[model samples]
Target: MTELALLVQGLLDGSIYALIAVGLTLVYGLLRILHVAHAALFTLGGYVGVVVTNETGSFILALVAAMIVAGIAGMIIYRLVYQPILHLPPYVALIASIGLFIAMQEGFRFYDEQGVSYVNPPVQGTLELAGQTLQLAKIVTFFVAIILIGGLGLLAAKTRTGVAWRATVTMPAMAESFGINIIQVRYINFFIGSALAAVAGVMVSLTTNLVEPTSGDVWSYKALAIIVLGGLGSMRGTLIACFALGVLEAFATTTCVPLGNIQICLGEIMNRDAIAFAFLVIVLMIRPQGLFVRA
Candidate 1:
């Protein structure tokens, strides 16, 4: 049962991180923004979604409205800030995104320290699976993350914007020459990627039963690690990295170490992500392009 519990918890946490990674990678691939604002946007999603859900008493509607609002926020950022940076050095855009991230964090800090409050779990029941009992909310979070990934996969494969987005990612000038309306496609990527970030925020709030402004900052790095370890712009590789990180996190926690010689407090940094970063460092040192690179 302990082993199974570790498995379930690991997957749930990893799936949540992967969702954030997809949104992060999408924006990075399309706009080359290196979005520092993603953490802010993710936290905003949680806060706003919580407010809407508490007010309207409708789970589904809260998600829809929150994502739409967040997408608008993304559009504004793109039009006002990022679009102008096209002619500038890449580092300029990077700096702007980081500034945006800090601004969002401070903005949220001004609003609430208790932060965007969350609702109690709607489905409080537990299900026994694989010889372990788990909360329905956790299970839902796992599946919902997968569904979002699946939906995005379909969009990438089937939609006109997806094709244009891909072309823009690979060769923006060439895509422009082909009449792809690169600007419009950039906006589309911005909106869709932002919406996915919001979805991740909502999933996290649901899973943890709390929302805070600082939450997004912690999550953004994990998503970045996923991108680094998964091979840049490889969606499939990113998802695989997510699960592998999740599993590694779970096993590490469960595998006990002799604390007598350990200098640091294990409890302070016991979660899967810390270990995942160490693994990432090791892997990158070894392979560099991640585990799933092509010839």
Candidate 2:
């Protein structure tokens, strides 16, 4: 791929990461929990999308259903699992989240050990742009992510709900005293976050045409690295980190380096995940508080 093509591909990849990481950042910012079960929710969305699309042959309907179901599940998790344990140490909630993730994965495996795939994907074929061929599903995924992320930005910046969310994050006691419903804000946070994850999951399934029981495993780790690298709980930082990682990974995997007389691609040397985490480690060594966190 040409330089411009690689750049575009990286940005497109970043859009997906942004969708996944944004949810983690939001939940962490508000509740100070890692929410590892989010990955399971993502996988759940993919399975739901696959089933709905196969049954109804409507991709739009699948997306909507996945978002609604995942959003509701998120709210329930918050109310039932996290609420009672909020006063405990943060690690306690994190452990519970990990357990929930494992249990959900097992449940999915029990449901379909072989995983699932979309029988009638809504988008097909590819588009050539800037000397690169891009999948139509990926293009759709990019646009959907942009719309959702942009809408999230608008919600955070322009609405009364945004004000309440910010207040709750900064000063929950004061927010409640001032008539803001902290519980509602928390619920909204999880709903929006989980919904975004579901959309991402559906998009991934569409792009790949497959949804495995463990589809979200790799993403869960990458999302954790992204939120932490971006500065835990910092949405803007998370967005920046997502794109940065994407572009870096793109170049790392595709660009060839001259070693002696032979051209060696980094992809041949280290996989994309290793490249991402190596970058994270390098960045953290320099900026221990994270790329965007204030000292």
Candidate 3:
């Protein structure tokens, strides 16, 4: 029963990671930018949702507004900072992204003054399944991850814009020759990515009941590691890696192992936060291209 509970919680946590990591994956694939500020956009969305919900007393409205604002902010950032350097070396854009990330973080700190705190969603409770309990907010967040991830997958696979996006990523010149507006596709991709991040941010706030300005600082690195572990540009890999890391961390936390004469705790030895990178190192050592990517 205890094991079951851990597994359940892990899956729920993984869903949020997927929601966040998938967006980072999309931006990397489409624009070839590191998007270091992606998680800052996520933290911004959480703050936005908190503010909107406080003002309106409506979680749904807050969710919608956060997504829209984050999406628009993504577009604006691209226009102002990324577009000019789009054709430059990837490293150049990466440095610019780091700068943008810092600016956004500081802006959030300045805007909130005392700093933003958590606002619980209207719904509150837990679900009991076969003797195990699950938080309602987490369940809702998991479902949202599923629906949005599925919807995004369908959009990328079936829609005309989706096709154009694939083409642009693979061969921008050829895609442009085929009449696909690369600039528009770039904007749309960033919008979708940032919007996804917004949803993830709100979910995190609801589940954890805290929204620090630095909330995204840790996640930004984790999401980046997730995409790399899942395979940089492969949405499939990102989703799998999210859950994989989540479950691994859960087990690491709950399970104890013996080493020589001493019992060593995985969580204590590696630390929960470092587990992602530990898995990353192991995966890279085994498959340098990532779990899903082919050489």
Report every candidate's CA lDDT.
Answer: 0.80, 0.91, 0.86
Clashes of each: 0, 0, 0
What range of 10 consecutive residues in model 2 has the weakest lDDT sum? 286-295
**lDDT for each residue of candidate 2 in 1-295, tens digit (9 for 90 to 100):** 8989888888989999999999999999988999999999899899999999999998889999999999999999999999999999999999999999999999999989988987767788999998789998888888899999999889888999998999888889999999998999999999999999999999988778888888998887898999999999888899999999888988899889898999988898889899899889999999998899821
Ranking by TM-score: 2, 3, 1
Task: State TM-scores per candidate.
Answer: 0.89, 0.96, 0.94
User: What lDDT tens digits, residue by residue, belong to model 1 across residues 111-183?
Assistant: 8877766555444578888777777877787888888788888887799877887888889999999999988
Q: Identify the candidate with maximal TM-score.
A: 2
- Indicate whether candidate 2 or candidate 3 has the larger lDDT: 2
lDDT (10s digit) by residue, model 3, range 155-180: 87999988998888888899999999
For candidate 1, the per-residue lDDT at 59 reads 79
Q: Cα lDDT of model 1 overall?
A: 0.80
Candidate ranking (lDDT, best to worst): 2, 3, 1
lDDT of 3 at 230: 82
Give the C-alpha miss distance for residue 275 in model 3, angstroms.
1.4
Q: Whose lDDT is greatest here?
A: 2
The weakest ten consecutive residues by lDDT in model 3 span: 113-122
